[model samples]
Target chain A: MTDDIAVLGAGMHPWGKWGRRFVEYGVTAARSALSDAQLGWNDVQLVVGADTVRGGYPGHVAGAAFAQALGWQGARVTSVYAACASGAQAINTARAQILAGMADVALVVGADAAPKGFFAPAGGDRPDDPDWLRFRVLGATNPVYFGLYARRRMALYGDTPDDFAQVKVKNAAAGRANPHARYRKAVTAEEVAASPVVADPLRLLDICATSDGAAALVLSSMSFARRHGVDPVRIRAVSTVTPRYPRTTLDLPDFATDSAAVVAPPAIGFRASIAAAAYAEAGTGPADLDLAEVYDLSTALELEWYEDVGLCPAGEGVKLLREGATALGGRIPVNPSGGLASFGEAVPAQAISQVCELTWQLRGQAGGRQVAGARCGLSVNQGLFGHGSAVIAVR
Target chain B: MRTPVVAGWFNADDDPDGFRLLGTRCRMCGSVFFPRADAYCRNPSCAGSELDEVPLSRTGTVWSYTDGRYRPPAPYPGTPDAPWEPYTVVAVELAAERMVVLGQAAPGVTVADLAVGMAVEVVPGVLHQDAERTWTTWHWRPVGGPV
Candidate 1:
């Protein structure tokens, strides 16, 4: 459990629709990270790229593609895809390599040029694929699932639409201070109520948008960090666990959940298990975390994450939000970098971006959105299908 | 002629009891799966490969519901010329199987008409129609509502 990797540098290209290739964004972020680490591209011995399905043939082999874009320095390359958890997996792969003594210095990168409107599955008729079948058969877009969760919250926890809108208001205020954020203007609750409904019980403003963005990290072995004369923030743990069988809760891209007729469901849900695994490995719990960056795909989902991350008991996420415990400068600030609400979703780049925010905060480098005296931070997100990821970083 | 959007999902032919959603139950462990787990039992503890086809519960309580206010992207087989109409989707918790199944609500049942824990029953309905065939799919209607 002592195999922690040092984060020497972190960087991101400002997230937005630049109408450019994802490789360009990735290269910019990588160059920035290399410069921040004071190491040239040739100095790194390994590189990992998070794959994006939208990026044609080169995207399929993103590791070699980004390496080629960075002028091919003969670095060992690997590409990984785990839907939205692609970035965390890429980071985990690098951490594994560094801890195993296979590499001294490694770079991890994830970038995406998202499609306009609701994200649909790759084309063609395939009834076997659940991702495709959900859209084709039920017309259940991603927002549909978000709306379902929101409504379920309202029913079970007495959460109101106004409570959901308050999440947008708070995150937008934080986004205004983040130069890297796409939407920098603070939003009013009225605006959220006025926004057209994309799915019932959730307005367009409640949901995160699709965008093109990139994030990168330069990681090194602890010994390498000490020799390089850098006091680096270290990644204590990366949890990339899958859901246990008979997953009771309904997740995205699935028509139905696994039946629990024969066996009882797990005591803790899949989302909770993600953070629990990370905390166990890091030897820290929710109380030890100074801040967190969770995937806020929708305003309601943000409230859900408050509970999922164990900031509060189940069905009491809204109470935490109401008490301002999750806002910036609160008891434990969540998503000080504006989260997906302001940054939108860059998919593969998002989980890495969360870690980047943590790194900057832990190092006291976050200009305006800094959480005061942040010592430890955790980033949690779940990908499409069963990929659940959580990473804890300590200064 | 009538056709199913996806074959073997549910019963399409007319029946008085209405169409029941089809699934598979593990013969060894008694675990049930929807969309038909033809290959193997998904339970981690059970190594049962003999899955038998079975009909799912017709009536269940609504776990949650939502409406799609936007036109979903392609592979959904929507006609561009026609005006888009929002439809309500419901996730119903089948008590017997101890699982939640999601499906479109019966035509004319808006989000206003649905609530969590309301009783709903599965029934066969038309999804869309082409010149040759009328694509059939399952719809969830509140039990004791208009047939």
Candidate 2:
């Protein structure tokens, strides 16, 4: 145990285009998390907010925004932004404070109101900026990258579109049980094939959507949890790792793949590094993981995670999924509370939201969609730029 | 005007066909890098290392491929006056190096024709242009024939 930082409470304002200010969503989830912890906003000794690029500026300073929304009482405040991994980074920051005894209680919140259509790089004509150059020169969208992976799978392993569609079917069934998920009804493979093609070899169902939502967590010292009359599920480790040099593979919105200019990159992939850091810190391995919540931006990416996370050997991910090893009641179920497949990305709020799902499962509080014995759980997400996040939680 | 040969990235290209992507290997760690990291070694396990520049193989196998279906957003700097022309992107796996590299597919290639595992070679293509000069970049072309 890395000096268990108690999760006093977990909260969310659901996920979808609620059409409200992101601050409103954060405050709502904040109040809910505090109330669930049986503590008041006034009780938090520190505040950390995940930034979400407010129009014309980087997303608002979430710490002060939430503090002011809840009526500030002069708590230590911090703001962080790391694209998609902002939420997890926020949690990590809060954990550091509590573990260091700088504060006995803290609040962590992440919220975002995403823009429509494909995610675009910031507007500018800088030649050095690869994000803009890729889009301007090649016209690649996020789906285009997804399509490349899907096609590669077909070429290498003969993974049919039907195989990709089945991932949607399974995740949708789990999503139907998650009230917090945006798209709830069950999906079928035929339905997935019927959906319009967003990119070659990938369909609308294969890609996750952008959404507006907020999630918040109340974290505190173990002593603080005991003081609150709760023996809470604790966060064991938070992995916020970055990719090694020569990020050789192509990612979304980048013009040229990383140049192998100086030194060889890791044989272990970037995604694997996210999980490896968590497992090392949490003192656990894939064999000990009961459930895993990974960023499934595309179905192919999720299968890649299965291999990177060590749930299956490389080139055997499709085999693991087809054999029911990662299903609802299988040996090591994945995304038991639905997944990004059911809930489109809400950016800043997502990494924290993964923790919320793990917390629910670890406590045996996840009803209907519960894994039989989910004692230890892992959450994984990748941020744009160089950010990545993962968390390990235990009851 | 003859191209500047892009320095050490490729052999001095009097002909555009002479272009190839350049990379460096850590003399100390034996790790390879592309786009030519000239300053220092980046191996976490290696010391501030002496490096050697080496031209990468001109060919590899296609790992996967896709084509742009829509005009991309700005900062990509396509003028409002230019008609949007979609292009293909290919992820190529070099078995000798055991690494996957991505680049634009050569002109006229589309997703309909390219297959994974097909042999392809890297070649130079114009990235963009202004009144003064044209920017050069790398592209992958199908071997034998354009599919």
> Model 1 over residues A1-395: C-alpha lDDT tens digits?
65889999888999999999899999999998998899999999999999888863543577887899999889999889998899999999999999999999999999989988999898988888999999988999999999999999999999999999999999999999998899999999999999999988999999999999999999999999999998899999999999998799999999998898779999888999999999999999999999999999999999988898889998999899989988998999999999999999999899999999999999998888899999999999998999979999999
RMSD of 1: 0.9
lDDT of 1 by residue, B17-131 (tens): 8678899989999889998988888898988899998999999999999999989998887797789999999999999999999999989999999999999999888888888
Which tens-of-lDDT digit does each residue in A106-199 have in candidate 2? 9999888878878887775664555665575556678888899788778777788988888888889999999899999999999999998777
Looking at every candidate separately, what fraction of the true A–B Cα contacts under 8 Å does it contain?
A: 0.87, 0.54
Q: What tens digits encode model 2's per-residue C-alpha lDDT throughout B24-60? A: 8778877666546677876676775678887777889
Q: How well is candidate 1 docked (DockQ)?
A: 0.90
Q: Per-candidate TM vs. native?
A: 0.99, 0.89
Clashing pairs in model 2, backbone N/Cα/C closer than 3 A: A52-A59, A53-A58, A53-A59, A54-A59, A136-B76, A260-B33, A260-B34, A261-B33, A261-B34, A261-B37
Angstrom error of the Cα, residue B97, model 2: value is 6.2
Candidate 1 global TM-score: 0.99
Position A38, candidate 1: lDDT: 91
